[model samples]
Target: MAGVRQNTSIPIPAIIRYDETDKNIIGHEFSLLEKAPGKSIDQIYHTLSVEVRTKMVHQMTDYLIELHAHPWDGYVGGLTPTNGEVTPGPPIDENFGQLPDLEKYWAGSESLESLNPIPSQGFAGFVAFTVGCLDHYIYLCILLAWFHLLRPLPSPECKGRRHERP
Candidate 1:
């Protein structure tokens, strides 16, 4: 978040505070962000003129280019609190599982045995890990859908019935 704010021209809400752990002051862990200007594109995109839509698309593409152009030190996981350093860890949500480690995903055994590990290799390992993670996610989704299908339905009385508001 900090890197995106500092390095890119993308307009994102300024993170006021981030709490990874909760002491329960607010009863939930949360991040406080400065109020962002304007509404969601969903609310107004259909109303935009062709010129405005073209400009929006161009701006979005420019932002993507600017973001991807940032030099990476070869680490492939998400940014860490260690000042943008990347580590093999759970991506976004750990509730699923962690990303594959470098040793596990490395293509060459010689590279794994090397005393001096190159950072560039990290990107390749990360890519392999991401692919495997995606497969795992798909399997999990299918399993979840099957479970939901097999689960007992709610009692008829528990189901909400809509009434006409007169």
Candidate 2:
């Protein structure tokens, strides 16, 4: 939200109140935002004039430039509220997905607990996370190769040769 607010070229909904603690709510913590004026781009995109569309693209490009210009704190994750201080943690998606969507790291109650950010050890944390995901992908590829070996695919018929199914 702060990132969007910092970029005036990007029009985002104003945050009214943000509650990270869910003690008052039934489910996950929530944030209340002021309703952004005007219809969503999805709704009016088809109706927009070519000039308006061009202007929108220019505005979006400006927003992206401004957004990317900000310096990061050398952390990989989301901002965690610890001892009333905002600290960086391992980046986790709000929907419980890992940064690169490798797999679920927790289950049941543990999933809820994982909402708290994992403390990233600078660049090492990101490196480890990436390495682990790559390893998992390689394992999956090996399994696929083994499956293909066990159940070989049928050969395609060529112009001169007649191929038989195994």
Candidate 3:
């Protein structure tokens, strides 16, 4: 993982953990991996310029292609060489056929109601106040413009004119 860089063939959020009970034994639910260093591709993207960013993107695509071509039989369940759950050998979709329960998922939709029953009158009042403030601002601007126009100044060159001295 020392050589791994931004947008390299590596999984995001390197760790995912879950809490469990005695029935679960708590020991088997981990995917310990060869740790990669530095920040994610997102961090790199923010710092890179437009031209460099395009090249970085192309490099990432190439990395993906290489990873896909070479099957990963090297590391099994754990990072260490000896003690790791032997992976089920080669590719097979893990969660392919199992259909997800839609009802349990949709149950969270009820929370959207809290965002409703909004204060319409308060919003209308805010809009009206804003309009009033805008009108006052416009009036002030017009008054200022008129005063500026009316105020007189002597000609820059004082050309072709005589001023009376008191």
Candidate with best TM-score: 1
- Candidate 1 has an lDDT of 0.56
TM-score of 3: 0.28
How do the residues 68-93 of candidate 2 rate in per-residue lDDT, one tens digit apiece?
A: 56555444445555574555544454
lDDT tens digits by residue: candidate 3, 1-166: 2113222465444433332112245533234455567767776777888998889789888877765454444322111112323222211112211112112323443221122222222223335545644554564455346455554566888766876532
Number of the top lDDT candidate: 1
Error of 1 at 85 (Å): 8.5
Arrange candidates by TM-score, highest first: which order? 1, 2, 3
Residue-level lDDT tens digits of model 1 in 1-166: 6657766778878778766543547644567999888888999999999999999999989998987676655445444455544233333434422222223434343232131222323344556656755765675566456455555666788679653322
RMSDs, each prediction?
A: 10.7, 9.3, 24.5
Supply candidate 3's per-residue lDDT for 68. 49
Off by over 4 Å in 1: 83-90, 94-126, 142-166
Error of 1 at 144 (Å): 4.0
Over 4 Å off, model 2:
3-11, 81-87, 97-166
Residue pair clashes in candidate 1: none
TM-score of each: 0.58, 0.52, 0.28
